[model samples]
Target: MLKGFLHHYYAFGLKVTSDWALPCSQRVQPTFATLEFRKQQAAFFAARVPRALRSQDPARIHYHDLEDGSRYLKWRGVFEFLISPDSQVVFGHSLDGAPAAAFRSYMLGHVFSYALLGFGIETFHATCVVVDGEAIAFLGDSARGKSTLAAAFLADGAELVTDDFLVLGREGKGYIAYPGLPRIKLYRSMSKHLLPARKGQRFTPGRVPKYLYPMEPVTKPQPLRAFYSLVSPDAIKSQTEVRIEALAPRQAYLEITENTFNVRVQTRERLESQFRWATEVVTRVPVKRLSYPRTLKVLPEVIAAVRADLQASR
Candidate 1:
């Protein structure tokens, strides 16, 4: 199901494939083929991707069309690339075999979103809710309630910028944050908790083998003041207070490097450059580890503390 409003992304053209089989909208949105390949495109993806990933995931067809002279698909990761009549490029995998197109698109999106941020803009996997003009990002692993936390901030009057990713760059000695890409992904369980339970809805779009989700209707991002890592409590007594600690460059590098979208596909030189950017980001921003109780009850307190921390630093 197309969850939110019928929004358009003026920044970039899109080809979407929905599991619910939603019909296309305008010239920009078409759920049909162009003039060439029909199911052959799917075979291309199937032939190129690995058997294991394919078995684990059979591409579900959504959207396929010609745009900007490139045939694009929003597909179910069922088939490997045989000869996707659109591209005729022949998509294939290495020994380890790449993930399906759906998974790879997101990872690729993140890398480019950050790299293309322009003039020091960097993307962070976090939920950014803008409070009083500054963006406070809630970073966490899947099921960590990043969006739930952002929603809490919104209820408390914070504006939503990006639910899953944030772009950070320097405006002066201070930094400026920008929103990159649209769409927020949610798990069925998580979606139920955050967006209200819908009958007969069993899974989210990026469910099963994937953990990342994208959110849209985001506000323009502002400068990043801090970075937080969401982790579970270390001890029973450590429940109430979130363990917000400053992060060193080495630690930030480790976290961002590992979690970056398709960090492995990046060349060695690119990896080093990203690493340097990570360090510069850590040094530029007040990076911290926000170890809080897993429940949503303490969300407000956490946001308040973050707000106060920024105020004090200022």
Candidate 2:
């Protein structure tokens, strides 16, 4: 641990201590931290070469696995994160004078998700929310409106559990979804439509920027109830009505596996274990296909349909 003054935070069921300010709940003197983030000298990373490169894009973002069990992630011309073998400590170095917000954007996202995988947590690329005391997750590909629907849920009085990265742990016969960072990323048009009163900070700069809006987070884990795999209406011609269809166990397992985070790093043994784990999950939790038109006007209707589905299942 690089010692000076460290900030303690709690997220995804882990107590974290970091040299930088994390956008999570702060805890004073946390007992037995589960993870630590420290700043390391650039020369430290410069001296080491990657043993196995995992990512396809070397110029943008690359994932490297070292022979010593440590992993390095580099965002070209921005920042890099080195995660310890035990996944307990993360050392970061900024490159090209990147701003603090940029560093944090990658840290809370890619870095944190990678660490969760190392810790043996089942991580998924999904946005989750709390509804009637149970956790509901929305899973889909990019531009499928998972975040937009989640933002709509938030406006309809649902609590944000996590956005983009969800970690699950076994609890009793079911799984519990842990709380993630207390922010949601939305496109500018969606931000204006759903959160008109709230001012959003642009985390990624581009011609079309995604804005991050901070919301009150659900600190405690909630029982995982259902998984909704969103289907774009454009894929189904003339499909105007929102539809929810229950998936069979085999299909559910496949869907979950497809949405799992950090699949490239998994060994054969790990992959087999994950397959079994996902099978067990689908046997307990329900997975459904949620299809609807990609439009803001029908958001309320979509939310009502989901609530009805959940209620009917219960």
TM-score of each: 0.58, 0.92
Q: Name every residue pair that clashes in candidate 2.
A: none
lDDT per residue as tens, model 1, 102-144: 4434433532342233222345567666777777667765566
Q: Return the TM-score for candidate 2, rounded to 2 decimals.
A: 0.92
Model 2 lDDT tens row, 61-102:
887778899989988878888999999889898887998898
- Give the residue spans of candidate 1 off by over 4 A: 1-122, 180-219, 233-238
**Candidate 1 lDDT score at position 206:** 36
